[model samples]
Target chain A: MRTAVKKQYKVAVLAGDGIGPEVMAEAEKVLQVVADKFQFGLTLTPALVGGAAIDASGEPLPAATLALCQQSDAILFGSVGGPKWTGLAPDKQPERGSLLPLRKTFDLFCNLRPGQIYPAFAELSPLHPRVSSQGMDVLCVRELTGGIYFGEKGRTDTDAFDTQRYSVAEIERIARVAFDAASKRSNKVTSIDKANVLQTSILWRETVERVAKDYPGVTLEHMYIDNAAMQLIRSPQQFDVLLCDNLFGDILSDEIAAIAGSLGLLPSASLNGNGFGLYEPAGGSAPDIAGKGIANPIAQILSAALMLRYSFGEEDAARAIEQAVQQCLAQHIVTRDINPNSTYGTAAVGAAIVATLRQENR
Target chain B: MRTAVKKQYKVAVLAGDGIGPEVMAEAEKVLQVVADKFQFGLTLTPALVGGAAIDASGEPLPAATLALCQQSDAILFGSVGGPKWTGLAPDKQPERGSLLPLRKTFDLFCNLRPGQIYPAFAELSPLHPRVSSQGMDVLCVRELTGGIYFGEKGRTDTDAFDTQRYSVAEIERIARVAFDAASKRSNKVTSIDKANVLQTSILWRETVERVAKDYPGVTLEHMYIDNAAMQLIRSPQQFDVLLCDNLFGDILSDEIAAIAGSLGLLPSASLNGNGFGLYEPAGGSAPDIAGKGIANPIAQILSAALMLRYSFGEEDAARAIEQAVQQCLAQHIVTRDINPNSTYGTAAVGAAIVATLRQENR
Candidate 1:
């Protein structure tokens, strides 16, 4: 029997703007620890995005960056968009230039946002003790590249318009992603929309129903967006996997992340059928906190863990990183975002997680 | 001096399907008491709706019912739609007939939903003790009539489309309603939308900003719907009034209601510029527990209070009814929904509230 050579996974890292560089540095540190512990052959390639790229070469996402992303096994993105580059026109906007291009280029159809409450930092949650005790953990599987967000728009003399469009093929493909995700978790997927009011939502529901037959093992439920919003607040734990269109997904996912306590700590991954995935923190670039040495790094570190599991097929590496994060929390080692009294900077928090990983490995 | 004659408000009562009848009856009882106490005249006109109407009159909302709603001073609508009526065509659906028509007919531009955690029923909430401590109370001022829900829709052979259209006028009018509402509350309004992604949302933000200048005393903040959703779950009390477009309003109002713990105790009022308003329970008709006589009547009773305040301008009566509700909860006179072991039926809950009001008056 011939021994096969294991391939080295390549990651394209886009440290966009503001705290993006700081957080991305922490993620890289965590990734290094994971690679060393798991003995996985990995190569990290850094690329420019957002205002950084705009400053360097008058383009937010240069051709070279795109080429690197295409060739990489996975992409780890830091936060994008800030007031500094917002004055630019629609096409020149850093967010559109970088994030949208990646989404469109990779055809990243499914965006996975897992809102999990870390037990140690549960005190930081603003929810009433009774509400938070129920364990607020939700996985929102948003249709990334379709629906109203990508629709055409125009403005007239007296009226303005934006198309809210969807196709059966689009809905079916996203529904399949949701069903697959539901199978891995609690096996329940709540498909949310405004089916009662919108034609697109009706089509969405119809397509979901049709596609649901293929995933007989997963339980499916339909809820209007309004009711879904209320249920999210009332009993978040009742939901396992939430499947929704692009616009509603954007709103609901953010809301779920907010409820979990800190936006600074939530990471997300957008993936496609080709195994090409883009992992990033759910938060945006806080320009005010830029270079302040106080921005949270946990979200980026967690994104690296997601990158390992999703792109590199290193489940053990992912688990090890996650366990190290939990241990850090258990030891009350956190950043200023969750605990202001403690004077830990971004690098300190990243160092803590890395130390925890090393200790656990030993 | 000429004595001003008190206006006799005409209220169209649509007691449709399941526990709808039970809750409607209780609301009617409370409203009658309010009329007597306030020395105002209220004529309750009954109308047919839902499956019951479809069965007996062959129409969910007959033309006569629409005419009655239009003629009435206000509408006190009970819940509609049930599994038994699911077979009906989309147009003939009970919810479409009763709910949508009522909204369209009146052009109810403003939806007012107040979510307050009852201190007496704090134990009933699933939230942990710390999360519910400060008490969650929010007034959701939702644009009821426009945005994506009411936009144009059609389907082609290859795709389906809906218009997510808004004009400056539409956004401005709704923004004014929110500002006016905030003036009466905690002087803060959070306008929610996806401004980063949608053109309609950007217009909505601009309109809200313009409207804010007119109400200099009221504090205004802009939040993306996603973040708003999270904030509602984490720190609901921090929000005083939430103003958003129709679609977002529908979702956020429901979410806010959920955080308050009991949908069975929430009520909403839809209003237009003409001073004509429609009051209804936020909770849907529970067909499953319909005839069991175990349905919670507090929400219905609260709807009656809203009817008194918004329709009849009997603010004192509204306050009395609200006080009575608080007294009922404080005295542990809740229905089975909040207190499962309690033997109180719909009638008993209504009677307790009425009795509390009478005692308070004495």
Candidate 2:
């Protein structure tokens, strides 16, 4: 019998603009440390994206960058779009060029947002004790690549219109994703929609019901989007996997992050047909705090870990990085965002995680 | 000089099935006491609706009820919909006949929901001390009758769609309502939408901007629905009038109620083209708790107060009823929902509020 050789994991890193570069640098450092500790053969290929690419090569996302992404096992994306690139036409905007292209290219169907409130950072949550005490940890699996966001748009002399459309295939595919995710976690999935009002939602609910037959092991429930919004605040712990459309997911995911405590510490992954996923921080590019050297890097670093597990199949490496992050927080080594009294800079906080990882390896 | 004849306010009261009858009775008692105290000439006309009508006349909302509502100065509606009537088809469902038709007949364009935290009920909030200390109060002004809810809907063999349609005129009208409301209350309005992704939202924002030019005194801000949802939980009091489309409003208003402490305490008003408005509790008919006298009547009573102010223009009567309810709560004479320890039944709570109004008059 011939010994099988494991494939090397290739990651396409898009460090876009502003704090993106800073955070990406820290995430890369953490990944390298994890790679060494776990003996995983990892290769990171840098690609120009967003305003940085537009500045250097006259395009926000060059054809070459897409080629690099196609070859890579996973893509780790930093934030895109800044005021400097806003003057560009709608299609050429940094966000449209890089973010939309990547999603479309890979047909990234599912957006997995894990809103976990770390035990160490529970105090940072703004929710009342009763609301937050239950430990708000939920994975929102949103159908990203379809729905109204990708619908047809046009303008006439009298009126402009955008179609809010969905297909049964789209709903079915996303429903399966949510059901599969629910099976892995708490075995409960709350499908959110406006079925009572929208024909699209009624179809969505029916399709979800049909797909749910394939996953009898997982519990399924339906909630109107409005009630879901209230329930998120009233008792977040009651939910497990929240499956919703792209638009509702975008709003609800952010809401979930706010409830979890801090937007600064959440990571997300967008995956599609090719097993290639784009991992990024749930937080936006904070232009106000861009050059302060004080932006929290945990979300970015964790995105790198997600890339390791989902894109590269390096579960051990991902677990090690996650543990190091937890250890750093446990030991009271945190950034200014989570611990205001802390005097640590972003680099210092990133270094602490690296140091913890080194010690754990020893 | 001839003295102007004082207008006599006429109210059409629809006391639907279950605890609707109980709450509506209390609301009527409170209204009568307020009318007497304020020396406002008022007449209350009872109308049959919902399951009660289904039993008596085999119709959910009889023609006589519609005529009575059309003649009244305002409609004071108790909760509708119950399991007993769920077997009916979509058109005959109590919600469609009593609720939808009422909205259509009134042409109620604006639905105003004020979520206030009563000091007596602060202990009932699930938030921790630090989070709930400031208390949360929000008034969500939702455009009641438009957006995707009323848009054209159809399904093909493979696809389904709902038009997220809004005209500039519609958006402008709703925006003016929000600005006017904000001027009266906290002088701040946060317009919520998905402007970044939806063309409908883009139009919505543009129309609001144009309308806002007229209301310079009111502070204006625009937030994506996602961020607004987060902000609602993070710092709810930061909002005054949260203006959004019918769809977003429906969801956000419910969320606002949840954050304010209890769904049982929120009231809403839906107004139409003819200046005729229907006032109702935000809480739906709880079929499970239908026959029990435990359903909170505060929301229902407050809805009647809204009916007086908005429809009848009986501001003094409205204020009197509001003050009585507040005094009752301040004195801890609340219902079972707000005060489980209290021995007060639905009728007793209503009587207490009526007594409070009479005492204030004395």
Which 10 successive residues of model 1 chain B have the least lDDT summed? B122-131
What is each candidate's fraction of native interface contacts (fnat)? 0.77, 0.78
For all predicted structures, in order, the TM-scores are: 0.88, 0.93
Q: Tens digit of lDDT per residue, candidate 2, span B175-248?
A: 88788767767788899988887888888888888788898898889999888888887777688889989888
lDDT for B88 (candidate 2)? 91
- The interface root mean square deviation of candidate 1 comes to 2.3
Interface RMSD of each: 2.3, 1.7
CAPRI category for model 2: medium
| Candidate 1 per-residue lDDT over residues B3-37, each given as its tens digit | 76876889999888889899899889888888887
DockQ (CA atoms), all models:
0.57, 0.68
- Tens-digit per-residue lDDT, A1-362, candidate 1: 97557658899999999999998999898888888887777888998998999999989999999999999999999987888888998888888888888888898998989897777777666555555667776889898887877799765533566788999988887888788778766889899988867899888988898888998999999998888786776667799999989988988887778678787889999999877899999888888999988899998998888888767778788988888888887877778788888788899989999998888887
